[model samples]
Target: MVYELKTKENENSVIEFIESVESPKKREDAYRLLDLFTAVTSYPAKMWGPSIIGFGSYHYKYASGHEGDAPLTGFSPRKAKISLYLSMEEGTYKRLAANFGKHTRGKACIYVNKVADIDVEVLKEMIKQSVNFSKKMGQS
Candidate 1:
């Protein structure tokens, strides 16, 4: 089942999820991610699924015939790392990743340990690209 976005009443649960992280550094990193995502996307960040913090919304269907609505882009604060979702066609992020400093990509997701580990300007550009890509996709 698809997870719905959280409501204002669910804010406490979101806060508590952030608070439950054992590492202070990771907790702060998650907040920084939240801030950066909000700043760049201008879409109110909402807790979606179990651990994902998402911005905006879109509908998608895979070539295999699976279809669903989901956040246009999002991230997750996991135990080992932070995952940033950049919604783009396959291979579109390759050039950006070359200048992104220390990061690992899995499909559309970019994983990093800390924001400082990557170039923020490149990140901003990537975010802009992803947002624009999603916008265009939504229009189609």
Candidate 2:
């Protein structure tokens, strides 16, 4: 049996989704992040599934034959922490992780308790690199 990807583009309003965040501080950070990502990626924010606010896009396929198109970079302001989605190969993520301020990680996603706890500049760099990497992967 084949399983489908759970996350995909949706028609939900990005602003509304941010507004729905229960934490006022998180909501504000979401807006700030939306602006920053939009400027950096030059791609409008789009709702991915029900939670993630994504920018740009690229297609990816793994050796196991799983393949799909996903946002080049994105974030989701969850109840406990904000989830940053990025792709940093060649130990780039490790380098960033060293100076990323207070954060936790799981493979591809970085979790921060709040935007203020992390360096916004570093976050921007991560997003930029991820976009470039995703574009190259798409072309190759």
Could you tell me every candidate's TM-score relative to the true structure? 0.82, 0.93
lDDT by residue for model 2 (111-130), tens: 99888898889888899988
Q: In model 2, what lDDT does residue 97 have?
A: 70
Best TM-score among the predictions, by candidate number: 2
lDDT of all predictions, in order shown? 0.77, 0.89
Worst 10 residues of 1 by lDDT: 3-12
The alpha-carbon lDDT assigned to residue 60 of candidate 1 equals: 65
lDDT of 2: 0.89
Q: Which candidate leads the pack in lDDT? A: 2
Worst 10 residues of 2 by lDDT: 90-99
Q: What TM-score would candidate 2 get against the native?
A: 0.93
Q: Give the poorly placed runs of model 1, Cα more than 4 Å off.
A: 1-13, 89-92
Model 1, range 4-53, lDDT digits (tens) per residue? 43421124355677778888998998888778878998988777766878
Clashing pairs in 1: none
* Superposed Cα deviation of residue 7, candidate 1 (Å): 15
